[model samples]
Target: MSDTVDETASGAATDPVLQRLSTLDRFLPIWIGVAMAVGLLLGRLVDGLDDALAAVEVGSVSLPIAIGLLIMMYPVLARVRYDELGHVTSDTRMLGASILLNWVLGPALMFALAWLLLPDLPEYRTGLIIVGLARCIAMVLIWNDLACGDREAAAILVAINAVFQILAFAFLGYFYLQVLPGWLGLEQTALDVSVWGIAKSVLVFLGIPLLAGFLTRTLGERARGRDWYESTFLPRIGPAALYGLLFTIVLLFALQGDTITSQPLDVARIAVPLLAYFVLMWGGAMLLTRALGFDYPRATAVSFTAAGNNFELAIAVAIGVFGVTSGQALAGVVGPLIEVPALVGLVYVSLWARRFFRDAPSTDPAVPDTGATR
Candidate 1:
């Protein structure tokens, strides 16, 4: 196990892709804080900008945020080798574990934490639940690649999570938010969660970008050749997603600056449960990987996929289900604020964890462990 970790670490020390993570990527948390500060300043100085941006909406989705999210998702999806999705059927253990973690455990954990921590703040509790139910499909790819995880497995898990989210997100959300609260004898305001509304947000936020990414990769590879497409074109386009992420953060904070400034304690209260959720989920996923005896790459992939949340989808849903100005929406905006830094730190932890796991054994005959970093 120690030798496998040593080799992976040594390989990572020289890996060009890992080394190329820019200053922006390394200090993403700092940049996010700067964005928040800038947004607050702009909100105070440039009165009516947030109102004007908020006016541009389509079916409850904010136009600027929708655009930012689409750009943020495209590069990550484009990197997926869709041809390798066939491998999903062979790795049933990994798939099953992901389903259990993402669908069952993740939401339940958030539900408990939100109720326990923010009992007086129902809107924030709902927002936390929304975030918990929406499993990650996009940024997990970036984190997986950065940590030298099994890219193919990461891609498959992402695809699986996307499908499950579309089918179950609405139903699960309805149950947790409306039905479960009633069942638990809590006085909760009834929320009209339309399945079609959830589906529409999923389609716009995920489905469209997914199709665009597929077409771009397919056409680009055929035109420029796979080597050039992978080596040159991808590197050029990949950072666009991170740029979009930062831009989106600034917009969100700017829009909510008044609320954030007035009720700073509410933001802190919302943040506490979110912080606990991330730490607990990451720790649990790591333990699960170790117990299952997954190799370094696969373990890292599973750990990240399990821990990360789809903040974009969560934000969209919060706006759609609740109003754009609702506390729920504000809480959704805070999700990525906390997630970006927490996951980035976890990336380093995952890299360090590789040294403790045994080399991927040749036991899984159906899907041979390739141990290929790329």
Candidate 2:
């Protein structure tokens, strides 16, 4: 059986799949909107708030954002059954497809779209390419879990991407930004990025939360037993994922609120390609995985993983390599702005599409059923 994410609690009142969502999950779009507005307002109104948050002393990582991301990711990671991770690791089809989607098709698609859509905007184009290179390591888990995806599979895929990012990000950045463009007879931009710099992002953003979650799960299960850990501890910690997500959204946008608010036109321009990329990547991943005969949970997990980008890493790389005020940074900032709402909407889309999977599990939280790896 597949050890997928158990999103809803037992005895949930809402019977329908969508209605089974808690109030927080139910109104996620609204909360995300409110968070975005509040962040933008804070950045615009408050003096030096953006600068202060941006100046955190975590080296490549921002402390405030780190806090929220760690909080956001820990619960989902903790929810993973490490013992069952073996099941996911053995699924060569999912693993191979994840690598192809995240590393190969994902970056190549972004390069084409960036060149095709924003030819004149070099900085933003470069920024979008960087976003595509940095695969989802932080927020994809939340989206996957919320969509009722395979928990262990998502965790395994995320970890693999993190390791791959550390190794390939700099090389890919150089190739795409300079080598590929030159080969294509387009304007080539050189990126002076270090492998360590990208590796630091992986360590801080993903490594910390991953370690914490592993420890929490190992300890919690050992001390409390699996039944107690699953039923009691997991339910309590599960809600923290959304809380961290909302908190991170607020800070992420707040740090760039002034930029987002003042430059509406540029934000919109950067957003167009980003919105398209998210939808296309997600939809394409879902379709490809489904065609491979994956069940809903596994397909959903892979789709979310492939579709999401590591905005945190992208923004950091852009700002660090291209300067904070560069157009690249702005493009990176605009990524989550488009991605948050888009992915949230896609969650509902995934739920709706579950009807097509004959082996789909009972999405209604009112009924308790575990799914198997198909």
Candidate 3:
């Protein structure tokens, strides 16, 4: 980690959080916009990458998405210090808030919003809902880390939510579409959620990387010096992950660029529900953290718990389950389009709101004082 990152991770006010926010504020939009353009251009250059993507699979899982998720996840795992998990877990308030916001509240709110707003667009409705239910597992950690959240709290929440999402993703899809009429579709809904299939993919995409991260951390402690790992390996994770993400984005947009080019209107339509979802999630999280008396890091974790979406997992699952041709797949693709920008915005909001809770009493400076846990 850089000196800037160390300060932010240490919870100092004059850390990378402010600088990152400032840099991202100035550069992210341009880079993301450039990403969109270059992605489209590069995406077009390789006409059959999407079709080639179809062949790269492990059993029922898609290879591209699996690889992408792994690349996206491992870097995050590299950043996690399991020691922090113990320290952060001791502060129950932050932990409790993180769990509730991510597992329970985030999915429910997303399902409800997608149901209410997406019905009119028959082609895209289910996809939108699926994307919504698949609340962010990895990027939330990234954003939380960026915002100077309690690392342990964020990691625990990430680990727990990831476990649940794998087990529940397919069931949630079935229930929301076929089983639960109020949340989304009615009797006419005929969507199939492959619980086992999703679980397997989760294993490959989430479980493997997480296990690898744990092993690396454990082994690195005894086999290698902490200084060597942090100094040589940790610093590289940020750029490598960023590169992987951009590459993944390029491939995804390339796969969907034709569709996007043909239907410019779809962008606006998808943006509406996504925007609303982010806004509602942010406001709800802020209120919940405040009402719960969460201190800074914990509240920020809760805020990101709601704010981020695992578009990578969602897209992969959508494609595997619904077929690439379905609108659900399209919705999953649309997720990153909206999410990248929205998360950046949420990061800003979390940082700006830091002053409000900075001095509030808490058990640990590392952990926030959300009332429920601590």
- Candidate 1 regions exceeding 4 Å error are 1-21, 360-374
On TM-score, the stronger of 2 and 3 is 2
The C-alpha local distance difference test score for the whole of candidate 3 amounts to 0.66
Candidate 2 error regions (>4 Å): 1-15, 360-374
How many clashes show up in model 2? 4
Residue-by-residue lDDT tens digits, candidate 2, 68-130: 998898888887888878878999999999999999999999999999999999999999999
Candidates ranked by lDDT: 2, 1, 3
Ranking of candidates on TM-score, top first: 2, 1, 3
- Candidate 1: C-alpha lDDT: 0.75
Instruction: Evaluate residue 225 in candidate 3 and report its C-alpha lDDT on the 0 to 100 scale.
Output: 78
| TM-score top scorer | 2
Q: Pick the candidate with the highest lDDT.
A: 2
Better model by TM-score: candidate 1 vs candidate 2: 2
Selected candidate, larger lDDT, 1 vs 3 = 1
List candidate 3 segments past 4 Å from native: 1-17, 20-26, 58-65, 182-188, 359-374
Error of 1 at 145 (Å): 3.4
